[model samples]
Target: MSARPAVRIVVVDDQEVVRAGFAALLDTQPDFTVVGTAADGGEAVLRCREQHPDVVLMDVRMPTMDGIEATRRIRAGADADAAPRILMLTTFDLDEHVYDALVAGAGGFLIKDVTAERLFDAVRVVAAGEALLAPSVTRRLIGEFTRLRPRPPAPELAELTPRETDVLRLVAEGLSNAEIAARLVVGEETVKTHVSRVLRRLGLRDRVQAVVVAYESGLVVPRSDVR
Candidate 1:
């Protein structure tokens, strides 16, 4: 058996010290490689195009090109298989726009003060092609936006099996695969298969988008009283 390849990473921040600290810390991990660093969003995209790393740690509020616009540009430009997973780093007060970052194609967002373990796990999770949606961040932020906007028609919601629909609702609720499997009295792999089917049927890029659909289609409501 062969060991998995190290997860290559690029850190993007306008603050030189912040970028260096992240790059230095991540480089110390055996399973991670800090391939490059950038001082702003524009430079980040250029580095990504050159390094083609597995994941990027992107700061949300940089000058010239904010992370949201950079994310939109990256997703727009990269070929499907070549797109690097992006994890947006944000301060708590800035999360109002973090939701926009997600919709713009960020794989996930992490609070800037997150523990080292959580940060590393977030990168690995996204690099594995799964969107990292925390219940605190993904659910609340998405639900808030969905509440402010009118529901969009998601005819594809009709395509999901009853079981798959149930799975997606649970996902939107921030349950992990194992937790969903336990709740539904099934195997974890079964839950994974159902999630994959839901993503395929809906043409979603990842779980984050699936969550967006669940909210926008009214599968889940922002307030507990509503649903």
Candidate 2:
């Protein structure tokens, strides 16, 4: 019999209690393993080099080295074959640096008080190469980019066919793949395929980036009727 592959994780936080709590929760799960814990950004980089974790739950604020710089250094070390996705945890107000983290190739951000289930789900999603774009954060991410100068060229919106465009728009509206499939009268797998293609076409890293692009490019607007 073969051993199951574990999802290696590193928890980086200045708070000892938070790090211990997260590590405890993850360690309790059968498939999730805590590879290491770091109290600050410099230690996070050292831990990453040693553990090569699949995901790092990084806090936005830390002493000596903050999460953003740590994320940048980690991403700079990413290879074509392997890269550890950094899931940043922050308080929405003070952590304006999250916008830079997003543009710097950090996978996504989560409010620190998010539920344990959501945290586990985020780990799985990011490990699977998806972005952890929550509905609440999507709007904020869009707001961050409004009127920014010299942004990358409007991502190749034309690459998506009409049906794919429909899927992308729906995703930007905070619809899940299952919901999209139900609305479009298609199999869930079909919706998933369309979403994958849309992300690929636009060179988006994941759903979060796709949603950001959709809002920034005016593909989806917050209507009173929707959500």
Q: Which segments of model 2 are wrong by more than 4 Å?
A: 1-3, 76-82, 93-95, 137-155, 223-227
**Model 2 residue 42 distance off true place after TM-score fit, in angstroms:** 3.3
lDDT of 1 by residue, 50-167 (tens): 9989998999999999988888888885654579999998877336678888878888888888889988888888888777875465677788878787577699999999999999
TM-scores, one per candidate: 0.88, 0.78
Instruction: Report lDDT (CA) for all predictions.
Output: 0.85, 0.79
- Please state every model's RMSD to the true fold in angstroms: 2.6, 3.5
* Backbone clash count for every predicted candidate, in the order shown: 0, 0
Q: Model 2: per-residue lDDT, tens digit, 1-227?
A: 99869999999999999999989998988889999999999999999999999999999889999998998898884661277888998877335578667666677788888888988888997887666665555455555454352244365987779999899888877677878999999999999899889878887656766776776677766453322
